[model samples]
Target chain A: MFELILTLVLLVIGFVFGQIAEKRHFRSIIQREAETRDLLCFNERRIPQDMFSPHVTLVCGSVVVSVDFFKHFVATLRNLVGGRVSAYESLLERARREAVLRMKAQALAQGATSVWNVRVETSSIHQGQRQGIGAVEVMAYGTALVPR
Target chain B: MGAYENRTVPEGINVSPVHPLKDFAVLLFGVSLSVIAFVIVLALLAGYLVRYVPFSYEQSLVSRAVAPWLEPSTDPLDQQRQRYLQSLADRLSSVMNLPDGMQVTVHYVQKDTVNAMATLGGHVVVFQGLLDVMPNENALAMVLAHEMAHVRYRHPIVATGRGFAVTLALSALAGIGDGVMERWVGQMGILPMLSFSRSQETEADALALESLQQSYGHVEGAAALFEYAAAETPVLSLPTLLATHPDHEDRIRRIQVFAQEHPPAMAPQLQPLPDYMKSKAKSNESQ
Candidate 1:
């Protein structure tokens, strides 16, 4: 019974560490997303007339978080050590979907019908810099146009 | 008596002499296990490091290291060509509604390929072969308009951004595994990025068409230029340009449809070239 209790305590401690790591990772991703969106906002204002399409300019934006965040988080767990790398694949997948969805929502709010020329850019911004907050920012933007 | 009691053994057994060899063996075993574990942890950390480091930072470092090895070009003919192209770009910009403080410069290349492109910071380059094939001012304008669209849309800057993003994303993924797996992620991600570039091209084309319509009276000239290009170059076909622009035939069809559905408010009034310009063209053609 004593051994059982000791094992339970160890497991709880490991779980707590995993949660803390995961939270840090999540915060970084969100902060990066905000920085990228800010950059895109700046770009929107600076577009010249030559860049503007008379028919319609559709701007779609997206962000992708690094998979390493989840990978590192899982690896840090003592019990999860030696397991297949695929153990945390689903978490990364979920993050990617969430990031893309948030971007789509922003694009929709901007009154874009369809986004063309879709391209994604990524940057690493140091935390506490005036320009951005996060380890890296991934941004996707393209002309949003109404179909003729 | 106290010292003797401390050294006493409870059982009646012989006290053996200390063995340096046995002590060394146990110590070696413990050290070996520790070394192995340390190596395993370091290996994992190294894998993560490789993934997280930005590729651009490495590229810049290498380029700086090799800067002395690169040769600088000093051809007078190239300089003259560049000046002529720059003058032409100035003329083109004077007729368009350009944003204040934005400067457009043009360069002419001696290459035989029929291609023209624009880079960020308003630098445009046209190939000599492309000039030879355009046949008329309107055709040249069409090409210029397209290149301008690329600049106005800031495609180059956006493209560089996308490239940087993908590299970082993949590098971060690389941290998740061994070298072999990281390489696989990099290779697999390339196709999606290429597709994304193709979409950007289409967007640029649409914008170019609209710009042409607004700047010129009729969208017909733009359409005619595409037709001429399609006839002159087999590579301009939709499949070939799909990476940058949609199929030429598709583009032409869309322009025609667009023209028919929504005619411009006023027909484009094309200005005749000056006598001096016409004479220059005639002389150049004879030469």
Candidate 2:
């Protein structure tokens, strides 16, 4: 009985805080993604030789996000019938976009006009395997080209 | 266009975030409810499927499956006492209402744990500690008959199958429910798991009492051992969920009441524990 109450309480807390946090995060991610959209980010590895710039360097950004108890609980339910865990899908999607935005910010900071060979790597960072993903770390990296 | 050519690309565009919390929450609730219904259907199907397995095959399957974990007992005392217990089992089996083709094989485990269990394949694992504690053959008879009742009804195999199905269901539940159900599933794969339903326990108890009534023509001291055990039952015990047996105290009272209603045809005379078994118990205890 106490456990049920505690679970409900945690769910409620997650619902309130998680909903607020995710909305805030998605907003930030959207705004940042749009801002970074024009930055020449690509997965292509051929670095355009010397045409771009001699100031070629690596720019990377990473973001780690955790799912609140409510979302995790939902994802676990989804696992039973074996469907897409859309909750975690959104989680990873948010993480990846945030990572990209940060990487673009780093490129802009370096005065680089464009970036190429963009790579986004994601991995599980915590032991929420049985449940849903506890937390995820996403890192976005690319080679920045400056017109130096 | 000239300004854009010279300026850093679109200074990080910002769009207002959409409101999705309400929709997400509602969708999650809907999905979870359906998932719950789906799980119930799966459990019912698994439960239904397990009942039709042929007795011989179930016995063979369960025996082979649990064989590796038995860790065969080598103690000399175990061998002697097992023979003692088996003969008693044979006597009771002769008179008890048993299922067709169900032959109880009593396996002696050398452990001192004061408990006995009926597992899959009509396997009754009796520990040495239980033998030492029995005041008389009557009490021991009660134990064997009780386990035999479990066998006649195929309780252990049904439980094992239930455990298997439930564990898979719980795995599917995964992150949805609280951690408690997961812990419950963790206990499933092992033998001698889960407390039998109260109905099953009562059924076994009644059957044992009937067997005692028939075998001795009088049931006496059969429940006395449980009275003693009830006194020793710990204040802190497994949660009802984890308890493999009914509370000895409550069960003792029930057994006494049950033994009285159907009076035995004659005064019961219980055989005392044999000296060889007593000596073996002492030696094993010393070790």
- Clashes per candidate, residues 3 or more apart or on different chains: 12, 3
User: Highest lDDT: which candidate?
Assistant: 2
lDDT per residue (tens digit) for residues B1-287 in model 2: 11222133332233223233554565556654554455456555765688788789987787688877775567665677778888889889999857778799888777677778888788888877777787888888898899999888777766667667766755774455556335323333221233335557878888888888788876787786577677786877766655656777777888778766876666767778786565464575778
Off by over 4 Å in 2: A1-66, A74-148, B1-48, B59-80, B169-198, B265-268, B279-287
- Candidate 1 lDDT by residue in tens digits, A1-148: 3543553464456456644654675566555555444222222333344334555554544454433322332322312134333324433433443455455556666654444455556555443443221244555555654333
Candidate 2 chain B, run of 10 with poorest lDDT? B1-10
lDDT of 2 at B37: 52
Q: Which residues of candidate 1, in runs, are more than 4 Å off?
A: A1-148, B1-96, B175-184, B224-244, B261-287
- lDDT score, candidate 1: 0.51
lDDT of each: 0.51, 0.72
**Per-residue accuracy of model 1 over B172-250 as CA lDDT, tens digit each:** 6454444333443444455455555666666666666665565565565556556766787655333442244556677
| Clashing residue pairs found in predicted model 2 | A31-B14, A35-B12, A35-B13
**Strongest candidate by DockQ:** 2
Residue A61 in model 2: shift from native, Å?
Answer: 13
TM-score of each: 0.41, 0.59
